[model samples]
Target: MSLKVKFDELKTLAGTELGTSDWIAVDQDRINTFADATDDHQWIHVDVEKAKTGPFGGTIAHGYLTLALLIPLWTELLDVEGVTTKVNYGLNKVRFPAPVPAGSRIRVTGKLGDVEEVPGNGLQLTADLVIEIENGTKPACIAQPVFRFYA
Candidate 1:
């Protein structure tokens, strides 16, 4: 595990890799639960037998499901100290470059891109996060996630 640092220290890390998260498995159960919650029971995501004959050769997680994992992955990777509140501003850009098949392990590598000071002792951070799949040529997702933290 990496040591936690104060939010101010993050500013010095601009244009550098902040951290990488531990591997997280994208299993069938997780995919099914997401599909159930979102009412997106697409054959490519849920039906293993059908998906085997489909394009991906096996059941794949939904792109949104992979996107949602960024939150937890980011949390596991870093911590912001001395902040009264931290909120997800939104993504500047997001792309699902490749599908993550069931049982595949994935992790996030975050690079601190830009950090700007806002009014009221707040800071806006833009992180370029890449979700890398284990043993896979392509990443599961790539996104520029933004956050606003108030001290």
Candidate 2:
């Protein structure tokens, strides 16, 4: 479930654990679509046959694919009311610690790190996020994403 809050209340939630998103499967079809869009058809990501003999023992989703999934997963975790606009400012840090094999399930958990005022009549939110693969040994991605909510 998402944490629904008003824009003005965001600051009060700093340092709070926002919670985890619902798990989504990273199937080959989605991986192929991302590969097509990004022109990143690396063997380990799309070449299922060859990838079977490659590292990870199967086809894996591209690192960026996992990173991109953060957007939808993030929206599932937080919903801010009373904002004119919401923008994904950018990421401060990102790391892919583990591969997400095709067909694997992934979910994200986040903590509201900081809430500060920005120049454009906006509130800047920094969230520390972790994307974990179900039953995997290590997290699929670790990222610090910044968001801006304008009044």
Candidate 3:
């Protein structure tokens, strides 16, 4: 279920599991677009046929590509209604534990963490995030993303 929280409620929810995002397909097209955008056309990520012989056994999504998807995925999980604006502060930690192969589906699960006040009537929100690959034993990515929300 989608959770809507106000500023105070957000603080209270810290350390609680948020929710999971809808499954998203990491297809060749999306991977190619990311490659073009970031100029990261590594054979293992953009070259499908050739990647069959490479590591991971096939084309895989760029680790950053998967991390970038967290924006939309986060929106699907929770909504902070009283914020005037929200900004991506930065990540505290990140890791890729498993490869996200092309044609695979993935989703993110998050938990609220620390919440601290920032300058100019803003709040810095932190969360522990994990991106899960469908049927995979290990998570594709783990991250702690911090966001600044202003009222």
Which one is best on TM-score? Answer: 2
Cα lDDT of model 2 by residue, 39-138, tens digit: 9988999999999999889999999999999999999999999999999999999999999999999999999999999987899999999999999999
lDDT per residue, candidate 3, 1-151, as tens digits? 5688886667677788888989999999999999999999999998888999997899999999999998988888889988889899899999999999999999999998998888988888899999999999999999999998888
Tell me the tens digit of each residue's lDDT in model 1 across 29-146: 9999999999999999999999999999999999999999999898876688899999999999999999999999999998888999989899898989999999999999999999
lDDT of each: 0.91, 0.96, 0.91
- Candidate 2 lDDT at 146 equals 98
TM-scores of the candidates in the order shown: 0.94, 0.98, 0.96
> Candidate 3: where are CA atoms >4 Å away?
none
Over 4 Å off in model 1, which ranges?
Answer: none
| lDDT comparison, 1 vs 3, better candidate | 3
The positional error of residue 62 in candidate 1, measured at the CA in angstroms, is 0.4
Which 10 consecutive residues of model 2 have the lowest summed lDDT?
112-121
- Model 1, residue 30: displacement in angstroms? 0.3
Model 2 lDDT, residue 117, Cα: 96
Cα lDDT over the full model 2: 0.96
